[model samples]
Target: MTFAPLDPVRLTADLIRCPSVTPAEGGALVLLQSVLKGAGFDCQRVDRNGIPNLFARWGEKGAAKTFGFNGHTDVVPVGDAAAWTHDPFGAEIVDGWLWGRGATDMKSGVAAFVAAAVDFVTQTPPDGAVILTITGDEEGAGRDGTRAILDWMEAQGEAMSVCLVGEPTCPDTLGDMMKIGRRGSMTGYFTAEGVQGHSAYPHRAKNPLHALVALLDRLTEWPLDGGTAHFDASTLQITTIDCGNPANNVIPARASATVNIRFNDAHTGNSLSDWLATHAEAVETETGVKIGLRCEISGESFVTPPGDFVALVADAVQAETGRRPDLSTSGGTSDARFVKNHCPVVEFGLVGRTMHQVDERVELAQIAALKAVYGRILARYFA
Candidate 1:
């Protein structure tokens, strides 16, 4: 039997009930597809390399401007379920808060946008188009999620005028802060190789540990960049160092360390990797040791400069909440980075205080307020 259409509160709870942990459908996409289809959206379940994603659009044919809502259906694994006051999948409401995994990290935002879409279709059928690009692989490697969908969209010649990612951007209150940009992230692994020898026989063998330490010192000795107007100063942090040698008298033949860099628009993954390679080579030459460097980038930094869409969203928030929102570029990487390639993307959502926590939750009032904000943005955008 078909369930009755759910409001934002019930919709959020319904989504949380699905347990769509990373790389798992968990029936979340099915539920979303059913709702969108019921609302007259042309729903297509796009699969890439065995990953589940959905693309739904509704409007008159030959529409010029398309406004899209993008989000992920995946939630981070609920660590230690017993630690939760309630079931992480229970979607319980107490003290005016709906509690569950993904409540704020994003199911709430998805529900808010879904409710907004429902409202939009009910009141005024779009003169253009309203689309959704929802993926189930966001919390994982992200190889087959938004990026793949974007490639598909590009091939189909579909263009979006503006896209909104509901990634829990608010720092203090709803609509208080909006993410206008994000820093890029890259991880590097370095290995220094040397001849194994007795620790006491210092004159006979090369010591890779010394070379590794010296290389790391050089890597972190200076900031990656000064703070940009829209982003903070870049930083490099060594997350791990390992030699795995237990013998007190034997020197390790090899040592490895992992470093992560959070950089601004001034750097890309290739550029940073080249920099590290050059530095590591310099150390290799000076110390007469072989050094290997490996790098992987999750995403590149991006900024949505002040534009028509940014102003439109900011104005909508102020008009609805009577408070001017701050435009921010502070956050980890999100699906917006992919959406940015297709159109202007901005992220504003529920307060992130409880996202990914044991008792993740959002206030009922805030859900309504977020819906209002989205509705206002829709009204303004379509105006």
Candidate 2:
């Protein structure tokens, strides 16, 4: 079969046009399937709970030396539309930059890898499988996204030896950084209960707002950990504090506060949850108010360590851009956390300076360079 060179720039534009905000298919997956199927690849829709996903494979399933690429089609909300200088979904390229939501956060990353893989298999047709697992739910509640596909793969006995996640990892320039792992992410919610009363009669009511504030102070002010070898210090941030009572003259019956934590390998979600519960108890005892705590773990800290997979990707980045990429674990959680359980995984992609911002954009040249880097990784991996 004849295979045309995949164009990351054009592919990225088509993806951005879909408006596939979290949980929405936005036609992104369909476009990919069309091209993939035409290239003699086997494709399947791994949709779960209404969230769309695409699982495509070239060569035999469960084959040795299978190389996988993981990424998302869904992007975050466009935020305030009025502030943008370009159409959020226009996929317009101006002055060499492609402007649109998901341009960097990573529609472009997906394009680079897909393009590379298609060209590789059509031209070389690797002895092992090349798998692309893309999900439409990464920017939203991630439970039904990559995790769902892994579950399906497990049931079917499918596996990949090494997986590369195409998340934008470079902070300043392309080939500057690649993530070997990511910090864990979790959120804690606290609700303080008290009697409602008028502000003039302070003694008649317990102030739940005071209790909630105390709880937040305790959590935010206390440090979680100093730092790790490959990661920075774990930190907790107070995200929101709210009381529905708008009246200045009345004390609310209940007040709530939420905190988000980005933890390193020094802590686990279980340990942090226990710590939050203990602090909640202390706040309740000190403020004479009842408090309830709820917690959710988005993902846990994980690393692939420096190994063959890491070296393969880092060498590719260095070869393309002439700069050795830093092996980092500084970013927030990603789908790689889940993929780690299935196979050794690492992340490398274009520079992500404007992801999720109003005028999110990517340099057109970077997209092509990224495709080149990915192509090199594939060529060498299947050699």
Worst 10 residues of 1 by lDDT: 1-10
Candidate 1 C-alpha lDDT tens digits along 1-383: 23343488888899999989988899999999998898888888888998899988888533787888999889999999999998999999998989899999788888888889877876776678888889998888999999888888887766677899988988887778988888999999999999889989967788899999999999988888898889999989999999999999998899999999999988888999999999999999999889999899988999999889899989988887777789998878898888888888998888899987888889999888888889888988888
Angstrom error of the Cα, residue 157, model 1: value is 2.7
lDDT of 1 at 296: 93
| Each prediction's TM-score versus the true structure | 0.97, 0.96
Top of the candidates by TM-score: 1
Steric clashes per prediction: 0, 0
lDDT, residue 369, candidate 2: 96
Residue 269 of model 2: what lDDT?
94
Displacement of residue 204 (Cα, Å) in model 2 is 3.1
Error of 2 at 43 (Å): 0.4
Q: Per-residue lDDT for 168 in model 2?
A: 94
